[model samples]
Target: MSEPLVKEYSNGEVTIVWKPDLCIHSGICLRGLPKVFNLKQRPWVQPEKANSDQIVALVRECPSKALSVKGVRFKEKDNSDVKVTLIPGGPILIKGGATVTERNHKQVHRETVAFCRCKRSRKFPYCDGTHAQPKED
Candidate 1:
């Protein structure tokens, strides 16, 4: 019910927009371009480290639509297939434009999303990186 958190990182030609609230921490960005999406670093995103084209390509791979480039339009994924993947210790990743029904009976469609399986996320159905944190007894 509040505004989603958005952060921007620019390399002049390309400006990467990040919506943390929509992020599933799928690691696609990190895995594709570690130099630009390093989690160990402060700010976490360093668009300046990579070329604009490279950055844009990786941002497009984001399943949750959490990462985007300013002034750029991403092609929608084909909705013909829906697949679900269960991570070993993380969230459940769903792809291919799946429709989700919330507790309030609101249905939402996502091209790619990660649902919380650890049952520790404050964000309820969505994974907010809480599963990666050390647990306390």
Candidate 2:
């Protein structure tokens, strides 16, 4: 197998390297920091867009092992049954063959679910343009 493309960014304190081939394109990086991880750009992932702590947090959220902390060793989980995605400013999207039981409904389906995090969503349990809304100072 060929080596994956790795991009590195640093702000003197620490550096972050991203492996695109391993990435699932969950959009977590871009959503977390558009100024850095602009998908529309030729070379995405600008470390200067955010601080080291913020970048590390977003990278750790990646479901896929695409993003990793530079020089840090970690173990890979067996993710054979679950599908994970890191959406920008949105909930981590998860889908695939799974079972979800509700109050009166026990459904087994292949569907995508978006979990909310911004907390300003009109659509609870999911994101609905809430992240785009301007925040009040």
**What is the C-alpha local distance difference test score of candidate 1?**
0.89
Where's the lowest-lDDT run of ten residues in candidate 2? 97-106
Candidate 2 per-residue lDDT, tens place, 31-124, comes to 6678867978766667776888787777777778688778766566466767888888667778765444433455545476666788887876
TM for every model, in the order presented, reads 0.58, 0.50
Off by over 4 Å in 1: 79-137
Q: What overall lDDT, based on C-alpha atoms, would model 2 receive against the true structure?
A: 0.72
Residue pair clashes in candidate 2 = 31-88
Q: How many backbone clashes does candidate 1 have?
A: 0
RMSD of each: 11.9, 13.7
Please report, as a residue range, the 10-residue window in candidate 1 with the lowest summed lDDT. 97-106
